[model samples]
Target: MKKLLAAALTGAAMLATPAMAQADEGKIQFKLLGTYVMPDGEITSVNTDIVGLPAGTQTTASDNFVPTLAIEYFVSPEFSIETICCMTQHDVDAVSGLTGAELVSDGKLIPATFTAKYHLNAGDVKPYVGAGATYFWWVDAEPGADTIPLGVTRTTLSDEFGFVVQAGVDIALGDGGMGVALDAKRYFVGTTARWYAGDTLAIETEHDLDPWVLSAGVSYRF
Candidate 1:
């Protein structure tokens, strides 16, 4: 991940020099976007491991395409505050290590975030990096008979804080009235789920909800 960030920064710097025609400062920019969540991350359950449910017991969230809306207020020529608006739904799945059976299927997770960005240069083509916080909520879980050993009846994931790191580039289109934006954000989210068995306290397990989100969109500046 560090290598990827370094490469992106290097590439963005190379592209920054030629597109220095400068965008308007203090303007509001809106983006209509499409996003893809890469399914390369994992969620671990030590409770399942403790119970010795299976050898390869693992949990993962599903990946899909989703729509997103983002608004950015350029505070200065090189700085902006951004908030992405969208309800992202992901299906969580747990697989049994022994029988290779799916234990929990179709559990849902949703996240929202806010970021502050620093544009590398005040140009028509802007490459920037950002840092932010995120809120993750777990909802609607379907745990099957395969998951009984974990004693999880009601699913309650602790709503907690997470950090976000992002990098993006905006390229001017036509005469610079509109543009295209390509962005990537990596979320560092880890939390514990309070599992209940029929109103009785059951288990607490760690879930690593880290995900890399990639987006592309059209941007309009005013």
Candidate 2:
């Protein structure tokens, strides 16, 4: 029994060594970070529903304004975890062609995401790239106004699971444990558009998020 207890104690003590090594490796101190994103282009899609509807009814998708904010934790010299939260407003143009009219639908606060990243450090200028999964919860949405015959607005965009890829580099500061970093990335975001007037209208669309995000900011090493 004593031998077993000693062995367990030794094992537990051994576990602490890595944490101590990491602590000895030290970490960066931080508070807040900001980022700005630009879409490679206006994301748009044209889709139509056939079978139940009369025919010739189609919807167009468009988006505007891209921005994101991230707070980072440097777990090691080459790894870190991060959360990216963003917002966007979209304009949907629907035309029946048969009815000879159009309805314009607008604005929504989309589902946001939390992600973990692996940072790669190189030279005095550290460069890193990695991937993470994100989940979005939708908020603040409204359907389009009447601009056509029986024209209903698109209210919400549904997104399930998504894949993200990232890349960035950092420049070290002479003192104060502070440095400047430049980062960029594209997230393959996915979602469904939901429409309703008294009945349910749903169609699958591609966000083509392939956003071209760029940011320059300061980081602190604890």
Candidate 3:
């Protein structure tokens, strides 16, 4: 009887281990993520006047695989708050009636979001959707002609507010609370792109700069 009881108890202990692990995995956690954004659109300055030099199209771009980080905490199984510290440096280029110029605008952007997440039934794969807001400030832009001139008050995006929509999924790890996840978000960053030389201000275009973000990383549930 003692030998039989010992074997049964060991089997029971093994069964309870995985169940306890799953329950503890529900705890809130943090993650560090990296992202790469590919810009596929153009921000242009249009000519309002029927005469004079025509306005031009300027392209903004970033180097491959920009570095970023994300942290997440769950208030409940269905809700969470997340924040990211990521920045972009765009090379600005223009060509207007055969006249060409270039410059750079670099800044750090922080996105803080509160989201309502619905976990899937399958514990191995969890997919969720979220919506939130964002704020971006033009931290530094080079001082030069043809670029957003330095210190032009409100001409550049000193600090602007916007909205964010995101989606992602988390894949479970090997019998652990740590796993991999993929996320993507669309940010509608309201812009204030201005051009003025002397008294004439060109089209004061408010940019609806919508950028797409894609990222993947490992996460842990504490």
Candidate 4:
């Protein structure tokens, strides 16, 4: 009777091992992060300069830090799909020619992005790399303080599509579905800025808005 009981206990242990391993791998994860947005807002070219912008007129966009939320779904143990939600604001100012002149103010945007990531699991540390697409949706924008003096009553930015590449790492705290996450993404995007005077378009300029996004925070999986 003791031999039979020992064999039964051994079989149960073998069955529990697989269940414990599966429990450690979660299917969904949520991350709350703080992100630093740094953008290069250099003017690539002037499409239409009705206001007679001075020669050597150059522009730049300001940087911002905001809260971000990321959701990830693991399709397999080594592959996952992820998306993030965040809204960032920026101001465009002249860096040269009319130095210190603000050209655009309070430009709010939402960068909708999706990525497919491959994770390399090395013990408790998992590193991932991904590439995906993004769409820059301009929610609101206004002419700057200086532009209002130039009969610029209204301003608009074109919504555009772009691409992004991502890399990050997740360090597991314990067997419990909690981890610390660090991520970085680089975006290649552009926009056309138009300033209007009543019903007439006054200025149109093309800008390169390549931005580097850095984030760090805690993540939970279930």
Top TM-score hit: 4
* lDDT, each prediction: 0.73, 0.56, 0.61, 0.94
What lDDT tens digits, residue by residue, belong to model 3 across residues 55-112? 4545454434666676777765557777777776554444334245553344334444
Off by over 4 Å in 2: 1-34, 38-67, 93-106, 145-149, 200-210
| lDDT digits (tens) for residues 34-60 of candidate 4 | 999999999998988777989999999
Relative to the true structure, candidate 1 reaches a TM of: 0.75
Question: lDDT, candidate 3, residue 93?
Answer: 44
- Write candidate 2's Cα lDDT for 1-222 as tens digits: 999999999999999886665464346434234555443312245353421443445554454545445667776766777765567655555445424222334445453554566655454576878678766455544665543235554455665666677788767676456777677666666555555544545433344444455666676666
Candidate ranking under lDDT, highest first, comes to 4, 1, 3, 2
Instruction: Summarize candidate 1's per-residue lDDT along 1-222 as a digit string, tens digits.
Output: 999999999999879855453443337999999998764325465653334444555666667788899999888777899988766555446644434444445556677789999998645678999999998765656654555666767655566689999999988786655899999999988766555678765545677778899999899887
Q: Which candidate would rank higher by lDDT, 2 or 3? A: 3
Per-candidate TM-scores read 0.75, 0.63, 0.70, 0.91
Off by over 4 Å in 3: 1-22, 39-41, 44-64, 95-100, 111-114, 143-155, 195-204
Model 1 misplaced stretches (Cα beyond 4 Å)? 1-26, 39-52, 95-100, 144-152
TM-score of 2: 0.63
Worst 10 residues of 2 by lDDT: 95-104
C-alpha root-mean-square deviation, candidate 4: 3.0
* Candidate 2 Cα RMSD (Å): 8.9
